[model samples]
Target: MSRLAGRRSAVDIVIGVVTHVTHHELFHDAARTLSGVDLEWVSYDHEDEIRDKVAEFLSTTRLDGFLAGPVPYTASQELLPPGLPVGVIRSSALDLTLALYRAQERGWGRTPVSIDTFPAEAVEAVATALDLDQDQIDCLPYAPSQSVDEIVAFHRDAFARFGERSYVISVRAAVRGQLSGQIPIMSGMPVPATIRTELHELALRIESDRASAQRFAAGVFLISDAPDEERARIALMNHLHNTPEFAGAWIENRGRRGVVVFAHKALFERITRNWVAVPALAEAAAALGARISAGFGVGVSARNCVLLAEQAAARAELAVEPCAYLFEDSGVVIGPMGPVGAALRYSYRSHGDDVERLAKYVGLSATTVSRLAALDQELQGRTLSPGELAGHLGITDQSGRRLIRTLDAGGLVSVEGTAQHHPKGRPTRLYRLRIAQALEAQPWSSPAATSSS
Candidate 1:
């Protein structure tokens, strides 16, 4: 900061992490409060590239000073080329060292360490603030950064690993004086994402219980049966949002469809384990003929969060009686066979009834109608040969053909296509359920959707 002092200089700080914007903002405020040096920040999708670009600002450039906003883990070859005095400020080295100690203390030690730094302090701050010994404090050295190229790549890799979590492209501390800010950005990720796939797999292990959640995020679950369900949910939402333990949260009906409960993704594991759903919903389910279940998901972005919540909601059905199974993995994944599965089965059964309706129209026997329904259900709406239908219904294949032809004459079922078996033998006919008229009393609404399944 002293380097930028007293000179009419333009300082550019490029940063990678959105959460770290506040730290940079404070730095600028202090400059105005103290040195009065003007600094401009240009934000981008990834930080490593931004740092490399900032590093190049040194060549053939008449800039006053450069601050690497938490650059390449401090004091490395990436330290703004050492052509000018550059200070790369991280929030607190001592605090970080203590965090490392806490993690290591859990015996979670390993080589090539990584810190998310978001949840550590937010959780334990009030209970335990900056208490470390000299041996413990030494862990906070600027992490080794070999070159600007390697250092920037490291940060980008870290950001990439945080995939499917909520992230955005934003700019802050805009440059008032300029060289143009147009630069090509590259992100190799697929569009329309949810949680990082790896993270979701890990989340599977985390049951929605109390203690397990303490590891993921802060705050406790707010079950329904509170004086007012919506009011309680709103209060908890606001409360968690304000807390550092909050990454984000949602309100779910719990196992009870009618009631709402507030849950923090940070604490979902505990809640799941506890069989916690909104009690009000449980009460309402008894009143309604059908039951209700609910669950919630959490993380960095609203879209990913909704995906998570829906995943939880899907699982809640598994816990409840109607739908008793939920599967993990998003998009085109198979689900369990409880109530929702039963609902699907019932729909197919209802469609089979049209065979009876057609039987009445064609004046076929009760046995014939039952046989046709059985064959139709298995064929999945595809036309079946009378021989195949007869084989399916334990009748002689030729007899089945005669039966189908009689029905075809009445337009109950149709021989839509034919295939020649042998020039001498005969041509095989294909018959399927005719939809000339609507069947009565439909079941479970329309066709199954992959989204709900």
Candidate 2:
């Protein structure tokens, strides 16, 4: 039964089924038939051809995801594209039971056996079901680099130990071929239910991808003028058009002001998948000599999204570097999208009145106070040295010390520790920002005013 059958306009999810042989091809066809999902089978004779075959399928077909049938899990992982979700059909308990039942017909049940398949866990599960221990069966689990000769040797050794009573169960057809005449080799292939389960998993992943793409997130990019600014705009448009995998048709040309719409999913996926992706994108842009300010926004409507994106763009423009900013729906503003954004969001909860009072008391701007609070959060509420405060404020140590004195006097910060300076100099005191406490203190009183009086 199709999970999507009752929908108003049901989309037939296109999937690529990759397998090695004709038998597995039939198995996958049955799987697709049972699944009630569209499947395109791409078979390769040799394991090495899996990469090329999968590439061909992706280029020709609109595949939602891939099902690696009878394909080694390790090989499938190596062959398929990094972005595509891959599900593998491997030996299950049913496979082991069915193979054993078949062997029982040939008077081989309860006999000592050797098996070669993917993962030892599968064999162990089957063994547990039959109330047998690991020592009773000789099992050689397949890894990516294991050779056919090694498999043959393992089977030969098992046969030597148990003689005629020894039976061989192999998942690989190649192993079956080599040991056909010598042992009662039964195929321990994945059951129909396992195949269906994997296909269902693939369907879920595709649905998730579609839903994520449909989510409304806006990006307003500030593309700095090139020598031929129009040419640069054209170049960017062409670049977007050429890469449908990333940009798709989800881009709008706003001329020299650049595109108001850049796909946030692309950037979001990149960031989620790789921690260094934000920095990586910046470095890539730098290498291309592209001075771009990208701001991402997500909201209910296009108007709100654009406004939020504009705010994000304004934030991005503050830094002298090329970066991306995200305007989240929760009113949390973050980014320069790399290292700066990594620590920028903490304490940016924006208590404007509170920040203003603290800034006045500390003889600092609201912006400086906000930055200090954010830094305090990054420091995990630890006391900060004057040098650290100076770096955060982009000021000299003397200026930082003077500001700290004002804040200390105003009760916005309290001295936590002191480090004695060399020889004759005064001690350097460390202070922790008490912005939350200052915020609660109600009316602002200027430490600068109090000192003068």
Candidate 3:
């Protein structure tokens, strides 16, 4: 049992593991070593049953984290709920090494072996460590599009070429089943150590997320141009008091025109549906017949939280229509939170002429370029596929593809690689936006150029 299991105050973490029936016992034995975790197994015997099984698991269980092998993850990626912590278990080099040792024990030498699903680098490293010839090894790295037949064919060809000397090592159970009778094969199942490490990491992530969600948050609601200040304030308070979502919140009046609320950050997130929309602001406006602006702040101290809320409320007041804004201690500003298309988020810091220059150079509007800049900052150097970018920008996939081409032409983005979220389609190209770098590279106006202008 882990230290977490010994803690009486520790909340039970439920983990859902999706895998083939063949590996159910293997995963169950591994999960037993994790004392505080409740493992819910969703096992499928065939590829076609994976999606329904995953959906059923999600609907039936409350999962703090999810785990699956690469094949199952790829098959059911689209079915998972957004923002859920997911861990994809890959066959480690250690697992591959064990499989090779097993083959050796069966009187098949490590040389002249065909392996599938393990990376080529891993194969080379193991073969080099074992003093095996690289030329005698045939490796087929895992691809999301790779089929069982293709793997079987690759191994069969290697065995045919190498005659009696060659054997196969496969990470996929289907491939082993396909080639079971005709060829010598070894299964490269992930060992318990690898599974345990992934589970521990996933549990830590879930705990961290829970802690962050429970942080203190403040919301300030202000009514502008109200005919009766006290009545409007009272009305706002009443509406919030009647709201089912705000039932747990602490609500009070801030000033003649403002109402304040205090609650866990998670409550606010639920009310706003994870910052996508705030229907309460719209509802308040319609009910009170006044222009209402709301600001939410999350900070280290209560005083700082209220100050930040006031600052965000001031920003909301400048907008032409009623809206809401969220200001965080980390300096992220998300708002004008109306409908989906109207909301925009960015850092509070000034962008100056760099955004304008980039926009003009790229033949896009300044606002679009600014949003892209904010998105680049939010990503923190992680690459995104066009489909994922579309989700972020609230646009169609085709539009995202077109925008990627435009950015590629303008030197604002570079293709990193391809990511196959699903098994059937072509892999989506991933790109990292270089908006900040592009802005820095723009030439400054010289004195002579200024004088000429």
Top candidate by lDDT = 3
Candidate 2 lDDT, tens digit per residue, 1-453?
Answer: 012223322576766776657456455544654444666776666656666666666677766676664333344443444445555566665778788888889888755889886445457657876887567698876444456677888999999988887889887766788898877788877667666766775677677667755667776666673566666666665655554444443677765656666454545545423212244335435544567676777677777778788887777778776666766554545454653335333225553345644454333444456666666667776888777788876777855765564455345676676777588876665778876666666434433222211
TM-score order of candidates, top first: 3, 2, 1
| lDDT (Cα, tens digit) per residue for candidate 3, span 256-309 | 999999999899889987765788988888889988888999999878888888
Per-residue lDDT of model 1, residues 113-136, tens digit only:
323211222222212344432221
Off by over 4 Å in 2: 1-10, 25-29, 32-36, 48-52, 55-59, 70-79, 220-291, 297-321, 325-453
Residue 203 of model 1: what lDDT? 24
Clashing pairs in 3: none
Worst 10 residues of 2 by lDDT: 1-10
Worst 10 residues of 1 by lDDT: 170-179
Better of 2 and 3 by lDDT: 3
**Candidate 1 local Cα displacement, residue 239, angstroms:** 78
Report each candidate's C-alpha RMSD, comma-separated, in the order given.
29.8, 22.3, 13.6
| Model 3 stretches astray by more than 4 angstroms | 1-10, 127-132, 225-231, 254-256, 307-321, 330-336, 339-453
Score every model by TM-score: 0.20, 0.53, 0.70
Clashing pairs in 2: none
